[model samples]
Target: MKLLEVKNLIKHFPVKNHKGQVVHAVDDVSFHINEGETLGLVGESGCGKSTCARTIIRIYDPTGGEIIFDGQNLATLSQRELKPIRKNMQMIFQDPYTSLNGRMTVRDIIAEPLIAHKIGNSQKERHEMVAQMLKQVGLNTEHGTRYAHEFSGGQRQRIGIARALILKPKLVICDEPISALDVSIQAQIINLLTEFQQKEKLTYLFIAHDLSVVEYISDHVGVMYLGKLVELSESKELYKNPLHPYTQGLLASIPALDIHAGKITDKAEMSGDLPSPISLPSGCRFCGRCPYAKKICAEAEPPMKEAAPGHMVACYLYS
Candidate 1:
């Protein structure tokens, strides 16, 4: 079942000292995540992947479009109205150092969600629940008294995961959850998240710049560029047959030693800096740097259309 559906989602930030100019963080983007499946969103840094995730989770109010979660439109809901719905949704932020509370013990940090939603009846009850969550995330109950700073980066992330899952949220937005950790530690975190998903039957919107990690964990993959969803397809299909030029360039940039050797056919290397979001081009956002850009690519933008079965791309070349 589709657990979260975002349609034509738009989020724009006003440029400082520039009247009437805005940074188009996420513009007319759309996708969905079904229950118990993972949807990985990948793009270059500053491509609005994190912004899309935040807007979906309501950290930032969307500028336009619909956000439907479990059949309810959340775009226009008031904060009071959103509170109840938030229990079924949670986010694991990118930075573990800043995401957790240092002043609070590990126990209180994990129990905050429970307290906010009034889950447990008594203090002792909540403590037990926190303890169980700690264990589930690979921490001991004794560590509950320690501060977030006392733990390593990996352990702190585990605490963050425990906090997010304490409420048993149906949808979890993992915003580059493993970006800050060591290479060795990244695998552990990924495995932990995978284990929890299977056990809890959770759905994930995993956002990252690392395509390798996204491919390993995601059932479907969506490629974004300059606030637009350029392409989307099943994980294997996207890696095997990336239609969009941007998607092809992204895959080519991946180290050749990557497990999927000889899979990428074309050397669609991207050049030049990304176009500024504040003053976007009238045509395709990637036209400025695309190697295969034609006159039509500069004349008008292309809408996302299916180029193959289960594969969608937004480019004039496909049209």
Candidate 2:
């Protein structure tokens, strides 16, 4: 069953004092995540990865397109209509330090969702629920009485995870949940999320720039560049053979150790910064930085086409 299906989703931020000028944050991107599946969205900073996730979860209202989740079109729903639906979907924001409330105790933070949705009958019951969730996320129940400021970065993140999962949401959008953590702590959080997914039969839309981490957790992976999906395929397939030039560039940039050569192989073959979203290129968004650009690439945008079974790419070379 498809838990979430985003079709031609668009989100644009208007430019200040510039009539008719808008930042194309997300443009006509489409993808889907089946129940109990994970889809990892990857790209450099400001590639609209987070914006896409935010739009789907209704943090920012989409400018256009459909947000179909659990057989309903959320794009058309109003705030009142969406309140009930919001419980089925939750988001783990990027910054753990800011995502949680400093004033609220850990118990109150985890129980907020339950209180909002009216999950428990009394305060004692909700406290018990929060305590259990704390233990599940590897936090001590005694810590629930403490404020978020008192915890370490990893411990704070664990609290955030507990709060997100306390409701047992059907779909969770993890927006770089571990990027701010220490390298050693990243794996523990990832492992915890994976374990929860297996036990709860949860579905996820995991967004991250770490290709290795994405490959490990995602069933399917989508590569975004300049607000467009340049490539998408099964995790192994996409890693083995990245079709889009942007995708290729991203994969090539991943550091690989060469023990025999006695040097770390880290080469970012693609050059040049991203073009201004205010005045985007007439054709492909990545044309300016693409090494394999053709004349037509600057004249017309390439449509996403399936180059092989279950592998999709947006490039004139594929067409």
Q: How big is the RMSD of model 2?
A: 1.8
- For candidate 1, give the lDDT: 0.94
Indicate which candidate wins on TM-score.
1
How much is the lDDT of residue 240 in candidate 2?
79
Among the numbered candidates, top lDDT falls to 1
Those runs of model 1 whose alpha carbons end farther than 4 Å from true positions after fitting are 258-260
lDDT string, candidate 2, 236-312, tens digits: 99987778888888877876765465222332378989888889999999999988889999999999999999999
| lDDT by candidate, in order shown | 0.94, 0.93
Name every residue pair that clashes in candidate 2: none
Question: Per-residue alpha-carbon lDDT of model 1 for 164-221, expressed as tens digits?
Answer: 9999999999999999999999999999999999999999999999999999999999
